[model samples]
Target: MTAISESGPSGFPPGYFLITSTATGRVLDVGGQAIDDGAELILWPSKEVSLVQSRRSPEADNQVFFVDDSGALCSRSSGHAIDIDHDRLVLRHRKPASFAHPFPKFSYHQELGEINVKFDGDPTRNMYILTSVPLRKPKSFIDDASQFLTTNIRTPFASLFGGVDTNSTPEQMTSAGVDLAEDEVLEEERGEEGEIDDSPDEKREIHMLTIPHQRPWNLAEKAKLRRRFEIIPLRTASKRTTGITV
Candidate 1:
């Protein structure tokens, strides 16, 4: 199996990708192309049975995923994020609840080639590693059982992104908006540039102008009225005051 990269390929943000398991050689799929909440994730054969195939496979939208800014693996078909519930992986709404944070953040581990889940900003917790196991569902939920995607294993079952698959070409990667050459050029340009200075260029004094309330304004009424104020920079105010009587 090809070693997975620690980080995603260049320009990989917001790009569609297939998460294929190294153990079973199957891709992570949403069961029944489901868009509803609590849909279980399963491992299914790839549309073309090749890791190098195009991401535009017919009826493969449920298989395509992109990492969101929050680091959640989001499904393109359901617009939901992969979440852990009762030690099982399922698709859930990405919105955060008042009591808990947003969906758990996921990071790719190069050494183990597994996707690690982080919860409540704790990394040392012996959480779970994404793995594929024989489907075990309640008889009431499903009649037939197959392979299911899970995260309740100690040993990590490595998965590879289609963009970083060894067999994938630059053109194939570019189809998902990853341009290796362009990223290389940009990286080189960044290295040649000088260090950036984040300090403010100039200091400015601020003067707030407040308008007094009318005579009829009582203390309560004054409190109710919104305060009107304007800010004047020291330099600009000084320029305006030049040649004017104080």
Candidate 2:
């Protein structure tokens, strides 16, 4: 349960990252390094180079874009951002006047660690999903941001993801065809070792300190996090943009 760092004022970590599509397995790319205003953004098949770029340590912004506070994806080289034009995502000069028309606000899906980009003043219409290539996908949706941030993204799902068990050994699952539910597999193993009825007189070592040490909770720190999530707006907006509709 490693804690995730709070992304900056822009609601995203400032660095170079490859935005990918979960449905298409494609990466969001700028065409021809276009710097003209209104240059269109398109999806391209992810390449080995794209993977390398996605995992690159935050360096020079060659293929990288900076997410600004207004939800604009700013090109590092051009100093422009991907602005919304009608329904199309394009590169444009981000200015105060065009803010209402082009810039998109974003929402985070806690379950999958996916970012949903939607138009400002509108929430439902034309929502686009954004993901990173190197990041680990989350297991299940958690309501609390603090809890979600602390959760392990690689945790195995009991019902979803084709029945993967993080605790199960490869040999054990290989014998079961890896199709059975994790509990069922564990039950069979438990059956082999019969349940024992322990006597009160029997002495067993109790590691009391281990439990508390495993989950270190500080009241002041938890209250601080709770307050932060409250201001952060975890819930999605109810309405979408004016022109777009479901």
Best by lDDT: 1
Q: Which parts of model 2 have CA positions greater than 4 angstroms off?
A: 1-11, 46-62, 96-102, 123-246
Q: What TM value does model 2 have?
A: 0.39
How close is every model to the real structure, measured as TM-score?
0.46, 0.39
Q: List residue ranges in candidate 1 displaced over 4 A.
A: 1-14, 49-55, 96-100, 121-124, 134-246
Q: In candidate 2, what are the lDDT values of residues 113-161, reduced to their tens digit?
A: 5555665565333334332211113324553454343333323343257
- lDDT of model 1 at position 70: 62
- Ten-residue segment with the worst summed lDDT in candidate 1? 227-236
Model 1 clash pairs are none
Candidate 1 lDDT over residue span 145-191, tens digit each: 21111221211222233223333333333433545543222212112
lDDT of 2: 0.42
Number of clashing residue pairs in every model?
Answer: 0, 4
RMSD of each: 28.9, 21.2
